[model samples]
Target: MNKLIGKKKITMENAFYLLKRIGFYKALKNIWNHNFEKSFLNKRFEQMISIEEKKGKEEKNEKLLIDLCECYLSLNNRFSSEILSICVPCLLKVGLKKDETDETQKEVEMTLLALSEIGYWEMKRGLYLNEIEAIIRYHHEHHNLSRLAYQSAWQFLIFRIYKDYSLEDVIVNELHFGREAARELKELRESVDWKRKEERGKEAKEVIVIWRWINAIDNYLTWCALWSEELVGFLGSIVQVFREVKDNHREVIYKCIYSLKNAAESRVIKVEELLKNEAVDVVLEEIHQPKLYDKMTYECLLFFLHISERLKEKEYFESDDKVRKTSKRVIFEKIEEEGYEDIISSFLETFDSLNIKLYPYLSLKISDYFVNV
Candidate 1:
């Protein structure tokens, strides 16, 4: 088993399956339980790192590292924090070399994948905020990390950190994180040839990273709106991506519209900005689609609700009531002309089937707007 693990011949799942077939699974679990008590695995990790530092060699033992990663995955979560404390520094020190030997690069990639899994585990349990901070700090300080590493770090921030930390703790306090992420998003948007299938396949890793950033923005829209100078450009990029990939990538369109919906709810982005970016047309077109899932339909409806609320605020508060009213009138006409009434009716008719609890209220709000418009 050790030979196979060191040789990367067996996966964690395969190892477990083999153990069960041989009826050693329970015995191995007992062994692991004992090791967990003694912190044996953690000590092994520390010993490996200590030996590496003492040797002072540029080439890493890739097979040993792969074996260690497998061992890390097999262990329970009891010593996760300790393991992460050891693994995080190792990952940073390795630093994802681009101009290194294949063996060294493989070692770095394996180390990163191991640390990412550990970090994700900690994030899911809402433990080890300090260690999470360390990873984020390392990513910020070391700009030369690979895209896979960047994606993992951002996903931890955008998806998991919010479980324990607030938007203010991470997004607001760490303002540069948002800006750097926006810059990365812009560069990714420009670099991709969205029209070419071959290009997308070639840049699949980057495309995944781009979606992670979009999701981060969607998750923290209020902060992005208040802090990101590129919020308008972010919205424009989403709409543009939606227009380019609307047919084949409905999921991407959903995320884009959801981000726009979040932008509307933030109340930081102007309705005119949305209109200028064709966000209104995008939502209308989605809602008018012949078949949309309930959640997608709900996002489209909520988008209109928020947009109308913004327009209503302008109608009441703006110094030029005539201009505000005319703007609101034109938008309402656009919605009405786009047959939003039918969309609302369709949603109401299928309200019982929708998974969203707020669907009925949202439907009525938009319905009232159309009736009064």
Candidate 2:
């Protein structure tokens, strides 16, 4: 009888040891919590969807949307992509309904809030590419949806897909969404009276979002280096906007310059194109600023370096020259006239100060113009 009791005790002890080794208790707790949260969110979402389907219940729908936005905000960021995947299609469908009533506007605004929240979270915690692709595909197929809906979808797309060059190409080339996005951005920019203080303040809420979209386009250009002529034509307007708002919006200006620097480095935008838009003047203004070794300084220096190298390449100039008076020579003269020697010195100094290793190779490439001169 004692042997039997001893054997039972040994078996129980072994079971306990195995449980501890594999974290059985913690794993079970996590599974239970996940199931509970999923069930709760599912129930709440289903209730909102049912209310959304009822007609003439505008008051209820408004409250329902408000509650829905609040619920999403209260949830954890880990669920952002999942929530967006479920919510975007439904919100888009409602946005497409042909009822241009006050109720619809409220719905649109609330939906924007919900989407922006999820987008922020998704962007913060690295986007889920597959989920985002699905959203983009659905959005592209329903491109002619309401204006607000279109903006919401594009906002998410820009935030998530900007860094993925292949996906960006699919959107820009095959899908043609890039053209649509550019048109919308142009309209949005035109809508604001940027010169009027009161009007600027009134539109300030949307300014950041608009700039973000622009930055995304600029990023895409950095990768592809070439876009349709219409899209390329829009670069001038972008530079013009930078000139107008640079003083008041330093962060926005930094992003604009950074994009220009990357675009120049990519060798896609020629010096002549930049000159036509007065981009050189913009870069010069930033270059002369007191702040040294900053992002703007680095970007401006690199911009000039790339431009100078392109100027040195005779083949590029010969192929591109068409009906213009020695396009390459004229462009080189124009840039030199802007005091590029000082810009080169600044670049060399800044790079040398930052890292001893990079200075030699960079100087070799950058000093070519001075050598030829």
Candidate 3:
């Protein structure tokens, strides 16, 4: 370490050679750990930041910059605010390199991903809201980049709404982070079409990233939440969540509740939106998911009750094959799993005890089907 820096400057050629010899991944990890990989060395993240601060701009090797960008992303959310105060700006500067070689383009690709990571972490915890927004916007209107940026922006907005602050502190009345100084988020929002950007990936993990932050919204932030069709579209994309995750799992259940609550509370997730998106069927199916059946008591009940309550004056089931099939399926599977007599007794017992008066809902219809069929 001393030998590399004792000469005071690392030439681009030495930088590239040293990086390749030591290996890109090793160098990236060591840059953060302040020691070669396998040695488990010292000075750690701060040492990496210092090295990048001094040489990141001067180093002409785009690959090195790419490695550093990756290093930055890796370190995000792993450390404290002190890290963000240093790392975020440094990586953004590296991302600005424009040598235009194929290597540099790859460097820029990883660099954009790193920037997205930084933006995402910062926004999730409600720090550097404006700076993170700028990093996201720097990716411009490209679908993938804009999608990530929007998702990060959405996270920041959720925290901002939930905490009721933009998180910018005013200094001596010079005002930073004040809503006035921040960019016009609402107007800026209108430009990026979220639904147009949400395409699927070959893998579920890849596809789920598009909806990761979308699941975080509720009534406190209604702009994107109000897009009931889009929200439900995201919900349908991950119908696997309802079926796969353990019944009472907090993360999946919370996301489901928040999506429903976002629509219900925002007054935009209408029945047509639910039905068109297959969201109703998804909810109906969830009642039969053994794991969720126990974990999502309120969400499961509220979803059906609310939907049923909403439909009471509107259609009264309206003779839809889909509705009948879904209700019948829910009843059959549930009875098969937990004996017909017990299934009927448990639900009706709960409904009677809850003292609910609502009629003309899915639950009652399901109950009636069990009694007759």
List where candidate 3 sits over 4 angstroms from the true fold: 1-43, 50-69, 72-78, 93-205, 210-258, 265-278, 289-293, 296-299, 302-373
Q: Per-residue lDDT tens digits of candidate 3, residues 1-373?
A: 3345446477544643444434333322223432232332113435555565566456744444345435544434343455555555545554455455666555544444444433223334433445545544444433333333344333433444334343322210222221311122222223333334332333322223323443433422354322222234444433444434323334644565546534443344555555555555555555555554433544555565555454443344434656545544554454465454443345654554333443333354443324122
Q: Which residue runs does candidate 1 get wrong by more than 4 Å?
A: 1-90, 95-143, 159-183, 186-201, 222-225, 313-327, 356-373
Instruction: Please tell me which predicted candidate would have the highest TM-score against the true structure.
Output: 1
- Residue pair clashes in candidate 1: none
Give lDDT per model, in order: 0.58, 0.53, 0.42
Which RMSD values do the candidates have, in order?
8.6, 14.0, 12.6
**Model 2 clash tally?**
0
- For each of the candidates, give the backbone clash count: 0, 0, 3
Comparing 1 and 3 on lDDT, the stronger one? 1
Model 1 scores worst on lDDT over the 10 consecutive residues at 22-31
As for candidate 2, its clashing pairs are: none
Model 1, span 238-303: residue lDDT tens:
777777767665666777888889877775566667777888888888888888877887787778
- Tens-place lDDT per residue, model 2, 35-151, is 423555445544554555454654455544544433443232334445455455545444444445676654554454345334333333233444444545655665434444455
